[model samples]
Structures are given as C-alpha cells and as structure tokens.
Target: MPIATIILAAGASTRLGGQPKQLLTHNGKTLIRQIADAALSLQSGPVIAILGSNYEQIQPELADLPLQVVLNPNWPEGMASSLKFGLKALIDEPVDAFLVVLTDQPYVTTDLLQELITTQQQTGRGIVACRYGEAGHLGVPALFDIRYGSEFMQLSGDIGARKLIKQYAGDCAEIPFPLAAIDLDTWQDVEAWSKRQGAGFEDQGTQPKS
Candidate 1:
C-alpha cells in the first residue's frame, strides 16, 4: 500500500527558550532532515514536512529532500493546526494510510515506521500507533487508515494524531517504541539527549518566527 507520511516540524519550541527543535543538529543533519529522510527512505509515497514559527529558516533544511513542504500559519494554535493542514494536503491522494512523524523523536527510524505499516497490514487494523513502552502510552508516529481522514481534519488546539489512536483503540495495533518517549521538547531535553549520545549542543540563540 502507498503510505503518505507527514513530518510535524511546525512547533515554536517554546520549552527550548524559543529554539526551533527542528533545526537542531543531530549526528550531522538537522532533526527535521533526519526524520524527513527516514520517511523518504521508505519510498512509500509522498512525504510532507509542515513548518511554522521559524519556517523561513527551517524550509531550507528540507529543500533538497523529495517531500512536500507546507507552512502552517496557524501553528501557534498547536499541533492540531499543523496536523489538519498536512492531512488536508494528502487526504485525497492515492494512499492507503497516513503516518504522522515528529521531528523531536530522535530515534524514530525507517524500520520502526515499516513495523507500523507491517503490523497494520498483518492485523488488518485501521490504526497502528506507538506505545512509548512506558505507562502504555499510545501516540505518533502513528498510522491511520484513509478512513480516518475526516477525523484528522477535525482536530483542533494542540491535540494531535494520538487523540485518534485513543478514540479508536479497539481498531488499533501497538508497536513497542520506547525510543519514541525520548522527545526534544526543552533545552534540558536536548542537553540530556545529546549528552547521552556523546555529543553536545549549545543553544544558538535561534529565535522563533511565529
């Protein structure tokens, strides 16, 4: 099945003192590029990276990648705005399912995403979501069958794809992704994550555009 993936890089990164987590360097590429490349690596279908806040600066990171770039003017409204916009862009495309990706999840890999797709195909489930492997947390990088396209558009506020995963739990399959629990939401988070990886990061004083 052709699967379209959306990389959510639209956040203002408020917790990181106005830094754009999407632009943060990981290994060699920016977090956004890493995640975008992971999606593209699948060669499944179109990949979309939603930008907002510091979109002007973030856009170039994804310019060379073969994926759709969407800027969310209402990104401040939260994840829901970006989610809805990305979903709208592909809801009518020839895709069997949608996989929502997050830039902050440093460990999300192509294999992991494939696992979600594989599980969905094997179980014949409509949704395939990740379990943080902690407290049974179910969230994105989640996959939703095209049947949930309308629900994706109706999301509002900061709520994201996780809401749909929870709402339709019975129809969902779970993949154990303890690494999904490690997200870069704050300066401390970045510091801790980098330190754990034997790397260091200096807050570059990057300001948000939104």
Candidate 2:
C-alpha cells in the first residue's frame, strides 16, 4: 500500500499580519518547500501541496520538486477546505493511506514522519496522530487510513481531524511528538523559539520554511 502526503499550505496567515508564512524564509528554503521535501524523502508515493492565498509566489518555490499542486478555491474559508480539496483531487490515485502535514512546523523531521507511517502500518489503525496533549492538540501531519476518505471530504469550518480521532478513538493511534507543538505563528514566536534553540534569530537553520 502506498502512502500519499498532503502538505496543507493554503492558510490565510491573518495572525502573522497578512504575511504568507509558507513563503517566509526560515532557512535557505521556504516553509512549504521544506515540508514538501521532508514528506517526499520519507514516502515514495505521490506528494500533493494544497495552495491558496499567495499561491503564485509559493508555486514557484516548489517548482522542479516532485510534487503535485492543487489550488483550493475555498481556502479563504478554513484549513479543512484545503484538506478536502487535496483529498478529493487524489480520489483516483493509488493511495492506501494519507499523511496530512503542515508547512509551518520547522521541527517536524522526516524521521518522525517515517515513524508515524511505520506505526500506522504495523497497527493497521484508522487514524494516527501526533499527540501534543489536552488542548485538543490535533492538526495536520496526521496519517489517516484510506478507510476514512469519505469522512475526510466531509470536514468543514476550521475543524481538522480531531472529530474523527474522537469518533474512532479505538482505531486511532497516538505518536507523542513534543516538537510538533512548536509551530511558527508569528514573528514573536519565531524569536522565542530561536532563543530557546540557542540559535541566532537571523539564522534560518532553526526555522522550517513552510
């Protein structure tokens, strides 16, 4: 069974003061590029990027990379819209499982992604999420068995896969990832994380470009 990775890059970064965070150069590459690269390295299946907002600027960043780009017209609505668009686009592909990831978590490594895939395969669970504890800490970078494709397409509003996780808790597996919680939402967040990482704020190595 092949695993397909959907990089959710279609968010309106209103909190970031209207800047498209995916295009922010945390290092040499943009956040979206870094996340897409990591996802491609881990799984050999098709990798799709859901683009919205400043799609044109970010589209060029992913050029030459082995990825499929799907524009989400309803991206302005919410994150769930992008997920639905991406999943619907791949309905005919030979996808056995789907790994939905965000382009903002610079700390998410290919190793962690591979581990999630392995765990999902081993347990044959319906949903596998990276646990960040009780703030309803569920978001992208989640792997869902193909069995839940219908449910994925039904997602709406600002909701993510948490509802499915709760509904299918018995069939879900949690992979604890503390680093996954460190996402860049604002310039202050970037500065604080850089300070904590003991790296210079100007250094892009500490930040992931998606």
Candidate 3:
C-alpha cells in the first residue's frame, strides 16, 4: 500500500499580518521546502502541495523539488477548501493511505512521519494523529486510511480532520509528539520559539535578525 502526502500551504496567514507564513525562512530553507523535503524523505508515494494566496511567489521556491503542485482558488474560504482540492487531485491515484500535513510545523521530521505511518499500518485503524505537548495534544501531521477518504472529502467549514477523528475516536490512535506543538505564526512567535530551541535568526536564513 502506497502512502501519499498532502501538504496544505494555502492558508491566508491572516493572523500573521497577511504574510505567507510558509515562505518564511527556517534553517536555510523556506518552511514549505523543509516540510516537503521531510515528507518526501519519509514516503515514496506522490507528494502534492496545495498552494493559494501568494501562489506565484511560493511556486518558484518549490520548482526544483519533486512534487506536484495544485492551486486552490477557493483557499480564501479556509483550510477545508485546500484539503478538498488536494484530495480531489489524488482521486485517480493509487494511494492506499494519506498523511495530511501543514507547512507550519517546522519541527516535524521524517522519523515522526514514518512512525505514524507504521503505527497506522500496524493498528489497522482508519485514523492516527500525532500527540503533542505533555498533555498529549493532537493535531494534523495525521494519517488516514483510504477507508475514510470519503469522510475526509466531506469535511467542511474551517474544521480539519479532528472532527472526523472525534467522530471515530474509538478507532483512532494518538502518537506522542511534544515538539509538534511548536509552530511559527508570527514574527514574535518565530523569535520566541527559535530562542527556546536555541535556533537563532541566522540559523533560519532570514533577512531580519531576531
């Protein structure tokens, strides 16, 4: 069974003062590139990125990578739109499962992704989420069996896969990942988190100094 990855990089970043957060630099590469590289490294299946907002600017950044790019014109509506667009593109592909990830999670690694994939395959569950923080927070960077692809496409509003996971909690499994909780949303958030991680602004390859 092949595992495909769908990276949602179409958000408006309204809370980040309208900047394309995925284009923000981190450790000598754009956040989106870092995420794409990590996902590609973990799984051999087709990797698709859903782009919107400043698509033109971000498109160039991913040109050299081996990834399929899909545009979400309805991205302004919210995350669900991007999710639907990506899933629609893969409707004809031979994918056995999917790992839905967000570009904002710079801390996500190939190892963590492989773990989720392995766990889902072993447990035979329809959904598996990464558990973050000491309290075991759950979010995206989740894996879903093809059995629930229809339910995934039915997702609406701004709510993500969490709604479906909640609907089928009895069959969902959570993997602890405290680092997944750290994500860049604002300049301040970027600096504060980088500082805590000892990742100076220079390490992020950004023009601005923290």
Candidate 4:
C-alpha cells in the first residue's frame, strides 16, 4: 500500500499575538521546516503540505523540500478545510493510505510515522492514531486507509480527524506517544520545548496556559 503524508500548516497564530506558529524556532530550525523535513524523509508515496493564512510567508521555508504544496483558500473555516483540500489534491494519486500530520508538533519524527504505518499494516486497521497525555487523548499524526477518503471529504468546519476516529474506534489502532501532546500553541510552549534542549526553563509543574 502506498502511503502519502498531508501536513496541515495553515492555522492562524491567534494565541501567539499574530505570530505564525509554524515559523517559531525549535532547535534552530523553524517548526514548519522541521516537520516538512521529517515528512519528506518518510518512505511514502507523496508528501503534500497544505498552507493557508500566511501562505506566502511560509512558502519560502519549504521551497527546497521535495513535496507538493496546496493552498487552502477556505482556511478560515478551520482545520477541516485544510484536511479536505489536501485529500482532494491527492485524489488522482495511487495512494492506499493517508497520513495527516501537524507542523506544530515539533517532536513528530520519521520514526514515529513509520511506527504508525507499521501498526496499521500489521493489524490491518482502517485507522491508526497516536495516543498521548495522562488522560490518553487520541490524535494525530494519524494514518487512515483509502477506504476512509469519502469520510474525510465529508468533514467540514472546525471538525478534525479525531471525530472520525472516535466514530470508528472499533476499527482503529493506536500507538502511545506521550510527547505528541507537547505541541507549540503559544509562547510558553515554545519556551518549554526549548527547555527540553538544555535551555534553563523551569517546568513550573503545570501545562503551559494555552
């Protein structure tokens, strides 16, 4: 089965005072660049990046990567629009599975992606998702069988793939990824993630106030 990756990088950084979260630096590289690099490195069919909001500004960052780029004009409608747009872009490709990933999850790696593919193939599940957090939240980076393409196309507004995963939980496989919960949503998140790399940042015993 040929698997393709769709990177959603269109969210407006409303919480970060208008800053582009995808442009935030982690370990010297911008978040989007980091995620794009990992996606491009995957042994998959095609890597497609969905850009919106600040598409022009983000375009240069990915100019050198080996991937297809698509713009989501209805990005203001939220994540679902980007998801639908990406799926539509890959309609003509011979893709058996699609992996939806977010650029803000700096910890997402080629290894973790490979794990999702491996689990999905081994268990023959139609959906494979990452499990995280103490409460065990299931989220991306997720892989879905082509059989779910129509379901994806039917999604609208702010709805995300998680809803689909929950609806079809019986046929889904999950891989635990505690760090997947650590995403860059605000300035505090950037600080915390930076601290992980030898920076002197105090954890303060609480999740960063989103």
How badly does each model clash, as a count of residue pairs? 0, 8, 1, 0
lDDT of 1 by residue, 175-206 (tens): 88888889989777887888899986543345
How many residue pairs of model 2 clash at the backbone? Answer: 8
TM-score per candidate: 0.94, 0.90, 0.92, 0.92
Tens-digit per-residue lDDT, 39-138, candidate 3: 8897559899999998987898889988899999998777888888888988998999899999887888898899998898789888899878666657
**Per-residue lDDT value at 175 in model 2:** 87
Query: If ranked by TM-score, best first, what sequence of candidates would result?
Result: 1, 4, 3, 2
Between 3 and 4, whose TM-score is larger? Answer: 4
Model 2 C-alpha lDDT per residue in residues 1-210, reported as the tens digit of each score: 788998889987777766778876654667787888898897558899999998887798888998899999899888789889888878889988889889778888788889888888889887888888457575456889888888977888877777788788899887888777788888787778778877644322334345
The reply for model 4, stretches above 4 Å from the true place, is 200-210
**What's the C-alpha lDDT at position 201 in model 3?**
43
Off by over 4 Å in 2: 133-139, 200-210
199 in model 3: Cα distance from truth in Å?
3.2
* lDDT of each candidate versus the true structure: 0.86, 0.81, 0.83, 0.86
Report the lDDT tens digits of candidate 4 across residue range 1-210.
789999999888787765688787644677788888888788688989999988888888889888898988899998999999899989899999999999888789999999999999899999999999888988899999988989988888999999999999999999999999998777777787777876532222223344
Best candidate per TM-score, number? 1
